[model samples]
Target: MDFQHLSYFIEVVRHASFSKAAQILHITQPTLSKIIKNLEDELEVILFNRTTRYIQLTDDGEIFLKFAHLTLSMADDLQVSLNDGKLLKKGKLSLGLPPVIGVSFFPHIIAKFRDLYPGIHLHLIEEGGKIVEQLLRDAKIDLGVVVLPVDERHFDFIPLVERQLSLIVNSNHTLAKQEIVHLSELRNESFILFKEGFSLNDRVREACIREGFEPVISYESSQWDLISEMVGVGLGIALLPETVLGRIHTESVKVIPKTVPQISWDLAVIWSKHHYLSHPARGWIQFIREWVWLQRSMI
Candidate 1:
């Protein structure tokens, strides 16, 4: 029998009344009864036992119910698989990126992805790395760019950038002339850092603690450019990813190429291990992997 007839039968059995099932299914009671009759005729058996008070399933009806449920389940699975393939042609993706990371990268990658998958709409959420991690956990975004050293147990990540942190000091600062500055030498200096939600905040703090002293904080900001601007004014020194140095146009600050205990500024694209990744999200990860590979080959 057809799926609709089987569904009506299940609803009748659920309510134990043809009138109640018809009301729930938004059809007439007579129509539901006729459909059930046709289903039983097709199976060549009495499917239901009817009485004035209530209705009950016959022996054949109980056996047919099991097969009906299995058939509907398989049909649903087939529909879902077909829909997933259609999604590859047109779908949406939500991606979270820290402000610093977005500025240093992703613009070109995003443009290229749009070129390749013109039908897929992209929604970008800009937040600090810590906030991005929270968004992923909450399932607010499909994928995220976060700083490395994340909880590997909770996330599945692909390493995007592996680099070291560079020190930036004002031109007039004593350490400006030095090509390489030891992390310990900056212990006495006022440090400008990224705000609380940024992963760099913790990374810098942990690195400083490893070097045997805590940094004396002078200011904190969410924007890397603002932090570097404060450094340019001789307010305090800041450590940032070396890749971002090219974008810091403030000639007042000089970047030190080397640090004694080199703190890493690695980045990774992450998604929650527990969350269900949509087709577009999975496609994005694959696209990025290929893009990164192409970039490395060009380099």
Candidate 2:
């Protein structure tokens, strides 16, 4: 059936009045009525029961409404996918990323994507997980690389990598030589943590609370590098993901695995469900999934 006819039919069903539907559609009542009549004839089904004062869907109309909604939704998705392809060929894709993940993977991903689709532009925004989530919710970025267990009701998450949390301490610290340590071991030690609004900070605090004590916070910094640097120089120990450790290596600091309520964080490709996925966004999603699979195979 013609999509326009289905559109009119859906509108009529929604309003339950031809004049109301036409007014909303910015079409005249007679034209709208004609379109619905033509749609019914084509389908060979009575779609509505019209009285002098009211319009109601017939039994067939009710059934058709469900299929109509589905068909329209799919059609819209198909159109969006097609338009996205054109965008990838000529437009740009904006990616919002957390600092640690962006530092490690953004260059490689951008290089690979440019090599494959030279025409598409790649824009990057470096922010913390909370900022990334806000940008996604606001439709500011097409996609985001963020830490997961985020409120999944608003955004869809695709896992990229899962890395264990590490306990970082100055080389001269008492726990520095240990290969593994429990959260309780650091109860009295002053800590350098990520500032408020960061997911990692919340994870670290929650893990500490579960161990029967809150962390002794000497300092908090949103800059990951600064936090690591502080821990390396005997300022205080900090909890960070394995990926961050890989980025900021310091001879003055050591990394040990955490065991009690073993904490790990997921790196995810996140996007809002309310926002439509652009072509480059979809392509990047596929590429990231394949890359993750390949990395797993190698491991």
Candidate 3:
């Protein structure tokens, strides 16, 4: 029940050796062992099974680990929130962004943010939307920019932009000369697409289904550049967001407006309503919202 005991128990589990845990915790091995034993006694459960050379979690310990992690995370957040004013000039802000946004927008924004708040440390992580969502839920990131359709119950989101999706093919491909192509006309054509769980891939599949057939997928990749390169080789055509298309430098590929209903994905800034945002985090969020709005208006 005591935080110190829980901390020691977690360290022991993490290292699987009391001596190593003690070394990491800057405590004696016997002290660390006593803490774990005390934690087990307080909880009325055996937390670990020990041998001369090894330590392993008991079934109860495995379950306890999950709660322990959550408890410690909450405690850390509380401390951070309470100390926010004192830490305002020296705190760290962590952000998560999907690949397209990271490549296209983050550089200038990050540079400006750092210039304005030189004392604040900024950490940005680039990942797929699913990973960014997980990081937000776990409180690993203060803010995340992700393609929309996230679980609205857990996050507060502000729509930044709607990215138009376009059908792209090799410039020399037969379809490239057409200003527009019906979705149904590509029913038999092989498609290079984003991997499963990506918003783009889902949109592409849904569009194809609306046209009366599932697409013939020839390749799937998470990287837009690779998808563009594959499409350039005449392997298959792809449906990608306009933002991603802007990043493509491959000369072989060309965008073709879809004749069917235009498809687009909304990009949003997402944050946990339950998590406390630090001063710097709040500032950066506002800056991002405003910057995105300005860019949208210009476009």
Misplaced by over 4 Å in model 2 are 1-84
Lowest lDDT 10-mer window, candidate 2?
97-106
The lDDT values for all models are 0.90, 0.84, 0.82
Mind giving the per-residue lDDT tens digits that candidate 2 earns over 1-299?
A: 78887888898888888999899999999999888888888889988988646888999999999999999999998888677686676567898876766666567867988888887788888777888899989999999887878898899878887877888889998888898898889899998987776778888889899999999899998787999899887899988887667877679988886666688888888899999888788888888888788888999
lDDT per residue (tens digit) for residues 141-207 in model 3: 9988888778988999888777677889999988899988889989899999877756667778888
Candidate 2 structure, TM-score to reference: 0.68
Model 1 root-mean-square deviation? 9.4
**Residue 18 CA displacement from its true place in model 2, Å:** 42
* Candidate ranking (lDDT, best to worst): 1, 2, 3
TM-score of decoy 1 = 0.74
The candidate maximizing lDDT is 1
Model 1: per-residue Cα lDDT at residue 257 = 79
Measured against the true structure, the TM-scores of the candidates, in listed sequence, are 0.74, 0.68, 0.66
